[model samples]
Target: MLKFDIFLSALANGLMTGAVYALIALGLTLVYGVLHIINFAHGATLTAAMFAVFVAHSVFKIDPYLAIVMLTPLFFGLGYAVQRFVINPASHGNDSNILLVTLGLSIIIENALLAGFRSDTRSIDVPYGFSVIEIGNLFLSTPKVVAFFASFVVAGLLWLLLARTDTGKAIRAVAREKTGAALSGINVDHIYAVTFGLGAACLAIAACLLMPTFLVNPRIGNAFVLVAFTIVVLGGMGSIAGALVGGLIIGVVESLSGLYFGESLGQIGIFLIFILVLLFRPTGLFGAKA
Candidate 1:
């Protein structure tokens, strides 16, 4: 049997990690929710954002936490322009074309990062990076705990954005029926861009939150992309709530699996559960049936 302290420690770690995972998945899921397409460039966008945070901290002397204020809108605008000009114009209403464009964009972004930053893995050293919160016998990393709470705040804000605002209503209308939304004078293309921007903005926030705890490289985001996709599928393709719940569950499972089976096999459990979810519940825990 596992020791109570050890198990509790793992569980706490899982939740903290899971919260950040959910934040990352929120971007991908939000894009899918509105655009109905898997953004192949999402992980790359995250990579870019992390680099932005890095640049802000190392060069501009802005704190990673403070970088959020600057980078989020910048990325949002970048996302908006990409969707408005590059993706929307090139795709011509075809899903496959959007996929290709995003894939191409990902390749370009990764290569740019490689050329600029090389393949070296970089990490930041904030003053509080080593700080931890002690509770009984458990010590939680401070950055991770802050990330945990911040994830909820972002999710809640996103929910309110979708539920309470006029833009949000327009987004929902376009998501549900693009033609009807357009006919109703809802500027579908603009809404599409906005949704995509929102997705990228989420990535910016996540990058900031993750920088203090995680390492960054051109390829680091790729490591999370598959896991994000799994969370997307597990929680339902377009279900925000599902993404949040699935992330936590996967985090816990990965933690426990790592504890028992070792690091190399830790990811196996995640995929196993993913496969089972696919086979048994293709619609996912919160997805609507097609």
Candidate 2:
């Protein structure tokens, strides 16, 4: 009975953590879906957005949730500029060139953050940030609960945008085939920027939701980006729904592993599952063959 309770607790927490993980993976998958290049700078963008929240909290005494309104456009614009200026010019280059360029950008962003913010850790101090709710033998984190529900809401909205909107149709068209999309009158470059911006925008929302629970630092992106990658690959490189499901699965496995083995072994479980998936389904659970 005690063991079962522990399992339940772990499962509850895992789902909450997975919600945030899905949001992060959504951003990554979106960029990869359209650009055909992984944004290595994604983690840095997350780090930046978290730091932006910290700035709003410190300088203006604003709550992290509300800060999303101010930060989203800025983050979107940054994504737009990076795609338009840095990435677009290199679109004609090989995959290696694109990867190296984004990786370089990531390094620069991390180091710039290190120089600016120093090594000290920072975080928001909301009263309920660390609060917990109890149900029977299970305990749920308030922040995680909030972040989890918010992620679902955002996911639903994203689905609506993609399924029902014209701009969303343009983004999907480009993702399917750039040249084909261009021939059909889509401004491929413009759509690319918008897609990148949308991806970045998702990260901003995640950053704000996560700020209350996570510590801010230069290397913080390093902490979660690997998991984000795992989720992205496991779900499918370009599948948004797959990312969400993958995030939840990874989260549950991680939580259970930590409980039975140890915290360090949790990552091993992820790798094992990832390897199996690669062996059996290289295109991923949701990815379609080209």
Candidate 3:
């Protein structure tokens, strides 16, 4: 009975953590869908957004949620400019070059952050940071619940935006085929910028929502990127729904493994699962047939 209770607790926490992972993976998958290029700098961009929100709270005493509102447009512009200037140049015939450019951008951003922030850990000091609620035999942290719900809401909103808007249709067209989209009067380059901006905005939102629950450091993004990649692959490289389900599966697996096997071994087990998924279902659970 005690072991079962423990498993239940782990499951609850796992679900919450999985929601956070899903948000991150959604951004990655969005870029992949539109550009057909992996944005390796995604984690770095998320870390930067975290730091931006942290600064807003620390320096201006803004609420973290309010900080997200303020920073969203800022990051959107940054993303637009980045895609317009830096990424678009390399986004030519060579898709591999896009990967190389993003990888280089990640390194540069990480090093810049280390230089600026000195590799120190930081966190948002929100009122509900350590608050939790107990329901019978189970415990649930307030921040984790908030993160989970917020992630779902954001993801749902994104889906609606893509499914309902004119701009979204253009983006979808570009994602389906750039040259064809351009011939059909869609500005492919503009669509690319908008897609990248939206993806960056999602990362910023995720960073802000998660700030109170996790430590922020220059390298924190690195820790989550692999998990994000795993989620992406498991879901199907560019499938939004895949990211959601994949993230939840990983979270539950990690939670159960940690509860039964031990912490270090749990991570190893998750990686093993990732490997198996890659070997067996490289197209992912929802990935379109290639």
Candidate 4:
């Protein structure tokens, strides 16, 4: 039988893990909400960011935390350029074209990483990598705790951006009605690029937070893609708060299920909830009725 204290500890761990998952889902949701395009390259972009952190650490002697400051804007710029120059031109306002372009981009990125770094799994040896916090009979990883809090901070800042900033308002306007937004003097294409950039920036931050605790390889980011999709769908297609709450809930469920059912089998719990959510609440927990 699992001890109550152990259960609590697992719950805590799940929340932390879910926070990162929320960050990943936030990027996906943002893009979907605004552009209405499912960015298949999102997972590859995340892998690229992880690799960016690793290279920054191993080659340039930068700390993972410190790399966040540098990588976030860099990724934002990359995403912007890709959306503006590559995806936009290639997609030509067609949904099928957009899907193909993003899917092709993902394949290109994955193969490029494979060719450059080979197939070896990589991780950094942070000075505080093994540090943990103890409270009562429970122990929590310090990196995870930091990630948990930082994820919320990022999400809050995102909310503030959307709720307060001019750029955010423009993005939201474009999301609601691009033709009206463009007629209102907003640069719709620029907004699309900006939204894509913001999504990539979120991934950069998530990657930095994950580096100390997670392993990285060319394919590592693919692991989060399905779960992120689940969170995005479960939270609703385009709801930010939904993504946050749904991620935490999924995290806890995954952790508890893992504890009782074992690690490999634990993943079934997430899909089960996903299926149930689809069958009963197709619009998702936070999604509006269509």
The runs of at least 3 residues in candidate 2 whose Cα sits more than 4 Å from the true structure, single-residue gaps closed, are 90-93
Ranking by lDDT: 4, 1, 3, 2
| lDDT, residue 90, model 4 | 96
> In candidate 4, what are the lDDT values of residues 230-255, reduced to their tens digit?
99999999889989998998899899
Error of 3 at 2 (Å): 2.5
What are the per-residue Cα lDDT tens digits for candidate 2 across 31-95? Answer: 89988889898999899889889989988999998988888888989999998898778756577
Report lDDT (CA) for all predictions: 0.92, 0.88, 0.88, 0.95
Q: lDDT of candidate 1 vs native?
A: 0.92
Looking at candidate 2, the ten consecutive residues that score lowest on lDDT are 87-96
Taking all chains together, the TM-score of candidate 1 against the true structure is 0.98
- Write model 1 residue lDDT over 69-161, tens digit each, in one string: 899999999999999999999999999999999999999999999999999999888999989999999999999999999999999999999
CA shift at 169, candidate 3, in angstroms? 1.4
C-alpha displacement of 105 in model 1, angstroms? 0.4
Best by lDDT: 4
Judging by lDDT, tell me the better candidate of 1 and 3. Answer: 1
Q: Of the pair 1 and 2, which is ahead by TM-score?
A: 1
